[model samples]
Target chain A: MIASGYLISVIAAMGIVTFALRALPFVAARWLQRHALVQALGQFLPLAIMTLLLVHSATGAALAHAGWPWPELLAVALVVVLQWTRRNALLSIVLGTCLYVLMRNFLV
Target chain B: MNDSNDPAHGPQRLSVLSLSAPVAMGYVPLGIVFGFLFVQAGASWWLAVLASLLVYAGAAQYMMIPMLAAGLSVGTIALATLIVNSRHVFYGLSLLDALPRRRLLRWYIVFALTDETYSVLTTIAATTSDRQKLLVALLNHCWWVLGTLIGALIGAQAQVALAGLDFVLAALFAVLTVEQWRTKKSAAPLWFALGAYALAYGVAAKHALLLSIVLSLVAGMLWQAKSAASGEVQR
Candidate 1:
């Protein structure tokens, strides 16, 4: 375990970086608003970032174990199907999470 | 556009808390899981509360537990967090024109623009009063903080049978990705993400997420530039 002082500092550091990122465009509002590169990135980056996060979550178990994470894959598939058909975020997340918990404990 | 400001349709009639109530369904459970994991990783409840209060980025907070347990350096943790929450930069872009003019309120809106809040704000009509927008942002922020406090208190008091609960974070991300894909109906970003992840994983298994994010952003920009050039030639 790390020291308490270090942990607090780490948390503070994370907060500072996060707040800075959030404040970037607001701080540089004029330049960012006029910059074509920033605009193009602003449009495309959200989906790409979301997809990257999904991959991070999906591959966490598989990467850790050096094998395919069947349960996670299947649960994510279920989430996609549920969200697509039902069009409900809460339902899809809750049901998919429950399925993952059940599968990891028993099936996997 | 002007209906929201009419005396009959005043802010008092539309309680900001009600607008934020729907988010509780998502935030409460996830916050509890984060708190539970934080305590499970042998951290104090106060630390969990402080992190949630200050950082307030869900995925980064989740990643912090494992990183902390592994005794990583503070600088490394900070860098990892910056990468994980880098998406917020773009989110801030989308809200630039809509954010309030007052410096303090604008800064607060910037500080509280979480993924959920961004989605809500962007989907709402542009005519929404600045007051309503700020109210929604503040209310959602409170929900997350309150949920984290509750979870930390519970996790500190008793051990809960939450063996597989960490997967909630994964599920939440999966759902959000699906939602974004559905809205955009574009496969290019998804393909770029997969390609980046595969390549990064081959190079560095542990840091693949950070690497893949950087790779994907670069690849996305290149693709955008190429497409723009081609359009110029055609025109």
Candidate 2:
């Protein structure tokens, strides 16, 4: 195992880099705001990014095992349906997650 | 606006924090999961706290657990983090006009802008004061940091093997994506994203996320450009 001091330094490096990524745009806000491409990205990119994240998460789960990730797939479906019908994010996520945990423990 | 005379300093600051209550539902649980996972990866609770305080990006921090265990180089970790959180740059673009001109507050807001806060701020009425926006940002930041610290403490003590809890991250993203779909009323972005992901997965499952994100963005921009050109043609 790496030493604690080295680990702490790594975390600090991570923190610095993350802060830089976040702060760069605000520092150049004027140019970014006026850029047509950035404007278009601002409008449409969130949905795409969100969708990519969903797929990435699901695929990560699925690829970890040889068989299908039944619980994950089911939980995602349940979450989507719940959010669609109820229009409540917290309820859907919390419930879907609980269902996934239960399925992972018992159903599998 | 004037930095010294900020509205957040006004009497209504409490309400701004209250407005962020909805975010607690997601941040609290997710933070706990991250803390638990961090400890499970053999890191101390203090590391989890340090991460939450410093790297506060939820998904990126979650990804850090596996990367840390693998003993990857710092450069790899930093690059992966940049790719994952690069979406924040877009968030900054959307919030730029709404942000206060004061240097410190602006920097804080920019640093604090996560996916949930961005969603909340963007949907808030345009007339909402800068102080309220700052409050929302601050409250969410506090919720996440505190939640992580609490979770780390519990996790360090219990050492409970809570397998499958990591799925919370996936579930959170699923909910967010569904919410976006419902509001936007267009399936093109979703389709493009799915297509890119599938293709990238086929080509390289390990690097599929980064590849798919790049592919999806390219496809989205191309589609937008084509549609705009067609509109001009019709006009």
Candidate 3:
């Protein structure tokens, strides 16, 4: 039913993008594995990418705001402190999300 | 170094099978909801599978249903999907270090960049080899394909209720996070995430959250290297 030409086209575009990203290393790395430059870069790349992910998750995509999105910020802060103190990711996300809802409801 | 010869394949396959019980326990309801929502949005079962395969980003898939429900444009949908999944770009880069040196292992590593694979791979990294990494990637890929295809197929015809199962993914991530914290010492990644979130929010207005992820991952690596070097010197 949702078979419009545009929707199909969009899906194809997405497929191409996803394929390219996933396909690059699959094709390139097969031959280049032992290359020194490649090896040197490999060690720290994951940490870097992950850091960006955490920061984005923590701050939640709002650069240049006046007061900041207090609730989301608060939620991220709580998750970090709890995770740091207790090393608990589950509690961090659950409690953080709860805090997010509360902040959305009353904090702002 | 062929895929079939990967030593990591055993653990990777085991982990895939290992996670399945939980997913089967989890995906049916979630898949049904996705199915119902897709159907409600005028998409066929076939379309759901296409979306799942082409755009395997989970939350984006859920969000797409609503966007379609609202009759949004294809361009708008594409842009939204891109933004939502922008964080995923980092996953490949991370695999570069451990899996990059071996070209044979590298190709398979990139194909399996889903959240589940990341969790499983990160957990087994210290113990992993080229074969192991390939197995992990391939096995993880199988899990997503199975969960998604099964969900789409079953969800299309029936009204199975998986309301609270949304938390299953959170729960899975929680499991992985706890394991990581207990076994490893690099809490910086988490902190980096929080810090990045804060920074992106404070200055930039464009989905500070996404910016934080990219920035935090970049910065986190810098800090990790700095600390690793200092630690190496102290030793």
The numbered model that scores best in TM-score is: 1
Can you give the lDDT of residue B63 in candidate 2? 72
- Best model number under lDDT: 1
DockQ of each: 0.62, 0.55, 0.18
Off by over 4 Å in 2: A1-21, A63-66, B1-13, B119-135, B183-185, B231-235
**Interface quality of candidate 2 as DockQ:** 0.55
lDDT of 2 at B61: 88
Per-residue CA lDDT of model 1 for B155-232, tens digit only, reads: 778875544666776777777777667767567888888888889989998888889888877876887797678868
Local accuracy of candidate 1 as per-residue lDDT tens digits, A10-101: 99999999999999977787787776666666556667777787778778754544346888888889988998898777788789889988
lDDT: worst 10-residue window of model 1 chain B:
B10-19
Clashes of each: 0, 0, 42
For candidate 1, give the lDDT. Answer: 0.79
- Candidates' C-alpha lDDT: 0.79, 0.78, 0.54
Tens-digit lDDT track for model 3 on A1-108?
566675677677665565565555545655445444333233333343334433433332232223566654565566656776776444565676566555544544
10 residues in a row with least lDDT, candidate 3 chain B: B163-172
Candidate 3: where are CA atoms >4 Å away? A19-108, B1-32, B100-105, B159-235
Q: Rate residue A32 of model 2 by lDDT.
A: 76
